[model samples]
Target: MTAVSIEKKVNGTPVASPELGEGRDHPDEEQHTPQPTPAAPSRREEKRLDKSTDRADARLDKAQEREEARRDADHKRETKEKERQAKADRKAQQRADKDKARAKRRKERRTAWTSLQTRLTHHMPMWGLPVVLVSLAVGATGQAGAASAAGMGWASAGVPVLTEGMTLTLAGLTGQAIEQRRPYAWLMRATWITAAGAATINALGHYIEGKAGDPQEALYRAAMYGVASMLGLVLWWVVMRSKRAAISGKTADEVARWKRLGRRHPLLMRRARRVADNTGKSMADAYATVWERANGARPGEPSIREIRASRRAAYRRRLAQSWDGRRGLRKQSERAAAVVPVPQADTVGTPESAGSAGVRTPVQAPALPVALLVPGGQGGWVEHPVPVLPMATPKRVRTGSDQSATARFPQGKDAVSKRVRKSVHDDRLNTVRALVESEAARGCDLRKHPSNRAVARAAGCRPGTARELLATVLAERGITR
Candidate 1:
């Protein structure tokens, strides 16, 4: 542990704890004396008995001396602890009492800042207040976030602590700008970019609404949220990008990563990009944490896609049964409809029905011969029949054993669904059976592989289910032979 300096006001001057050693006054002495013996009657005693008694007394004295030493040490420790606690309490009280005054002073300074800021509003026409607030908020927020991260664990804290130092430096520079004639534009931009980026990410989450369903709706919502959230971010970034491009003589969007390394300069776009990237990484971690919570997994655990796939396959099988039977019913309907005779045009009507010359009246039109009817009809009459295109009728087909369809095809090609796609992506199982067969041939033990990685390679099978299926297949084929 690092030596922590605790300031002490021993007299009228402040002294670090190391100087005082937080000294504890020694404990009061405790005496343990041997039991006093009465003068032997007439001073006469056996030599052996007297010697034994003397030895026993010596042992007692040794034990008492050791006990006294231990007691003294414990007492000193306790007293020091008490004094340390007392001093800490006094300091805490002082800080609490002084907090109001500190806050008052801070507020006065902030108000003076406001007045100065108002006077420079037009003078600082190029930038805006949101940028300044966002910068301060980001700097403060980064400081706070880094502090929080530092407390999580050593493995997690190292990089974050480093980043915290970097952010504090940036914030210090930015804070100094509140008094600078011309503030470092990059530092100012860094804060604004950070805030805007945060807003964008938050909006992105709201937009996605989870992958529960309605991809289009989710995408639309995400886009709308992103656009709305980035309105301010976009404006700020554009302004910053423009200024950066002007200074570096590079394009607005481009910034060399090397320039961001240990950056002490203020107007560097690379610095903002670095901080924004760090924020993104943290955001991604938070998102991953949330994902794990929803899925009942720890961080970096594989998604239980096989279990989901099994459930989906079951559901699709059920739907197939419900829907496959409907095809026959549809076929029957089509056959029955094919036999119904189409009505002729003479029995229908003509547009000339309203004429009284050689053109027949509406009452006489129906009596005209079918051939003489001009094979035509009025607007409301039924139109001529159109030839129906032939449909490939569905035959009764079995979904077959293996419950997974890839088994039936000799080439071992993947079974494509006319319905939904599988949960695992295609790259994992580029050649579904080749993966399974080759692994089986090698006598490879999947237990040796990472569960999720192995399962993904097994044609998106659940790790457990895939193991079972492989055993079954091997047994059926006598691979053990």
Candidate 2:
């Protein structure tokens, strides 16, 4: 053990203590150093840290949610905008399609109206305009007079004239606009009659009613009507001449239209062509006449072919009737002949007619001797036993015109008939040849008209003569038939 010292200070003086020799240092001792104490966290700091962690997490969550909502809104807005745009486009397309259909119908009606007007203008009578105007004027004037007599409120002297004049003028203007330049002959006559009747009625009204309001005016109106009528006549004549010239000088389009119409109306065209051929008229004139007939004008004259066909039809009908009558008469005659008895010749009964009743009995001819006596003996000489005549012997005739036969006794008659026929044929050949030659020289096409009947008609010869002449001509031409 080691000794240790102790010291003490009391008040201000130093002092030593005896008991201070306490235990001293040991060899193995430990020393301890003083350390400061750690402090605990505050409540505010802990709360602030918790609040900051929570705020950071909450902010991240809020940002993610906002992004999701923005994406959703953008997608929804895009879908809604596409749907609205599609709806607007569909509505606009429907509106555009409806406007195109109404424009096509208006064009078709205008063309038809023009064609009708042209047709009416061409067909109506021209002279009827003035005549109808005059009659209307007279009728209106009479109506006004009647109204005046009845004490109507509309009755005025000027009213009648104004109405009459306006109506007549309108009618005249309509006639002119319609291009009426000429009337048919019958229509002209009717119009003239109507005009005369109107004039008579007007004169009678003026004279009887003691209303000769203005004679000069009446004369002037009459002159105006007369002048209009005369002018219409002149204009109609000029228009007719011009139309005739136009028809004669047909345009290409007119000619083509006519051709198309002719093809459609083939029968009418054929008739027109026939008329043109027979009457020596121009084909255009005949075609125009036929077209007019088809358009409701007077019918054209019958063609030569039509006349001939009618005549032929009538002749055939008469011939058929006569033929039927003749056939009936013949049948009647046959029946009468069958009903009546016929006389029979009486003779010896033959083997064929032995059993049948009312059959004619056939007579047997006697056989002649094969030998004949010549005039070697006198006429009064008796029949002597003559030798049998040879079959090859020829017969001789005594008369000048009698024919001689070179055949045997049995065939002599046939030979003589043939010789006589040959002589007659030879005599007819000369006259037939002359007639045929004359027909040939007259430009007859003998080959096409090689018929004997045709030759007979043309050559004024018999059919047999014509046939003989044809044979001769054919032989001359080295054309044997």
Candidate 3:
């Protein structure tokens, strides 16, 4: 059994047992004491720590919230600012647009004002007025000088009526020169009229004095004065013109105006298209003429009006299909028949004559009734049987020496010659041409017409060639479009 001992020591707790080796040095002491352990903290302490932690957390949250709020506020402010900026920009654009419109209006107004100013300021003289005034002045002045010179003679002779007239003429002439501002050229002409007037006045004054005063001597002196006055007037005119030439630069107001008025009048320009068109020619030719005149004046011959009228008449007649025209054509066709070969009679004894032999008059059938003569009988009925003349086989004459050529021509006197054959071909072509022309006149497109090839074949040419030839012939005659 294990012993349980208790021991106590100063400043030491009781030891219940001593170890074997350590027992000699110190008595054993035994103590049973449980260590004191701290209990769980109070609610208050836990609450304090929790509160501290919570406060830190809260501070962080508050900082985060503040930061986020600030950011949000900043974002809102930025958005508002952007909107405000947009509004401001719109307003600015509106203002700018208004300014632009105002500027345009202002420019228009300025241009209008400038135009008005130009019109308002523009001015020119009345029609030819200044010229007439100058003419009168020059005429009167020259007349006065002549009168003054002749007056001396009259004064010496003492004719009271004449003396007063000479003085009056001189005074009126001097007053006219200073008052008028007419053209110088007119003034020059005025000088001539004035000189003539002065000479006449002087002559009258002297004549009157010669009759009233010392009859014989006065009469001689009067004649001398009249001659002197005329001479003086002529000299005065020469002097004025020489002086005008010597004067340089443009004449004062009068001289400058005279220069302007001196220009040759320009010929009136007007459109000639109406007259040109009225001229008888193709419209294309007329238009070409107009273009020529408009560009350079390498003028072509003007279309003849008479020729046009004639062509128009022909056109009208053709369009109307006049009976006279048809009759004339029939006559032409009959005339053309002269070239066609006549089929000779095949009778054993009938004589072959140019007029007597024809297919239309059948020699074999004598006096057949007109009803029996008709082809494809009336009411589509069969015609009465009558012996009709057979087409005479063309007789060939052996004009050639060759045996081979003799085979084609029989021993007939009326055998066709090469020349005759050519003539017949020409006649057939002419007939075909006439037919083509009639069709063309009916407004057919000859280019595509089926008859055109046949006509061309008869014409011994291509279709286009035939058309070209027809066009040229018609155009030359000016009969068809």
Candidate 4:
């Protein structure tokens, strides 16, 4: 059995210890023991616990408020920074757009300035207005001075308006007449007369005013006043002329050409006028028709056929007169002839044979002389002749056809052989043949071929030569028109 012992009690309750045998069924202890009830907590301790809980809650709320404020400040700062950046971008974009527009306008202005017509006529009014105003002011002053000198004291101011006004009114009428395409010669003459009279009056007035000071100064003042009074008239006349030209659809060059033509040929202009009235045609058409009839083909111009004929005649004359007014064929006969194979049917006839057969043949021209005209001892011209050596003739090849002919030429360093001549002829013929083929391909009738001028241009020869070549080619191809 364990021993039991009694222990000291707290709060008036006794405790039993097992080692002291106090917890055993103690026959020595009281059988009926009273248990002690638990006591309630004290008021002071409860109050202390409530105070500590309130302090913790208050600290948590303050920390939450501080966190919320810090977050709001950060959000505001971020928003402001974004807004600033957006504003900067917007401003930069605006500047870029403005700069682009400005550059476009500048480029447009530069392009507009590149044309000569624009340069001459654009902004003419802007420049002319200032000149007109200045001229009016100076003319008025000169007229007033002149009128006062002429014993019209207060009436002098009205005199300038009458004189200058007449000129201006006449000029306006002239402009109106020009716009209507009516005859404005009388208006122009009247305007000029009025302007001259006004200028004279202004000059006289200025001279009278300045004569009291110095005679030379008075003359200078008179000239200055006169010119100033006429300055506006001159500018107005120029404007009127420009407007007239524009309305008439005549360019400056066309006006200059007409003026030159009129100056050179007054009778022609009168004849053109009569033709215009009789034929009911425009002056230009009448002039052109009359000119073509008086001259030939184009106005004041010769036909291509005539030009080529003249050139060929001149060339032949020069060739004939090359050696002291002779045929100049002796030099050509001295050189050896090269061998050139030519078909019998294609053989060109001699001049005498051509006259009988009505076939034209090309005559061989002589060479130029190897002589230089040097200054003579007595100041007269003397010929210094140079010696020329003969060349070896090429061997001729005989064809099977008895009618076939071979032209021979010399083979040397300086000789222009018959082979070269034939080749040049062949080139010209080939050019004409190609032109014919092209025309035929384009559906043109071979009977009616192109003009001689076109063939001449294509073959790089004169019209006469081209005409002959074309005829030869046509005859070979059995085409006749």
The candidates, ranked best first by TM-score, are 4, 2, 1, 3
Candidate number that wins on TM-score, 1 or 2 = 2
Tell me the tens digit of each residue's lDDT in model 1 across 1-481. Answer: 7756688554345544533344334334343333434544333456677888999999999999999999999999999999999999999989987997899999999999888876544223236756544543543343343334335344433432444345445544554554343447688767655545544443445444444678778667656544543454445445444544455555534454424422643333333334335434333343343343234333354334544567578766544433321234455455534433334446445454545577653432111112211244554544333322333345435454424433212221223331112322232243334555666678876334223445433333356655554444445556531
Worst 10 residues of 4 by lDDT: 407-416
Listed per candidate, the RMSD to the true structure in angstroms reads: 37.2, 33.3, 33.7, 21.4
Output the lDDT of residue 402, model 2: 40
Q: What is the TM-score of each candidate against the true structure?
A: 0.20, 0.27, 0.20, 0.39
lDDT assessment of candidate 4: 0.72
Task: Enumerate residue pairs that collide in model 3.
Answer: 14-29, 14-30, 15-29, 15-30, 16-29, 16-30, 138-190, 139-190, 139-194
For model 1, which pairs clash?
none
Candidate 3, residues 428-470: lDDT per residue as tens digits?
4564567567768888765444255555654444578666656
Better of 1 and 4 by TM-score: 4
Question: Tens digit of lDDT per residue, candidate 4, span 12-110?
Answer: 666664445455576576555536657755889779889898999999999999999999999999999999999999999999999999999998888
Give the better candidate number (3 or 4) by lDDT.
4
Clash number by candidate, in order: 0, 0, 9, 17
* Cα lDDT for residue 148, candidate 1: 44
Once fitted onto the true fold, the runs of candidate 1 whose alpha carbons sit more than 4 angstroms away are 1-235, 239-334, 337-386, 400-414, 417-481
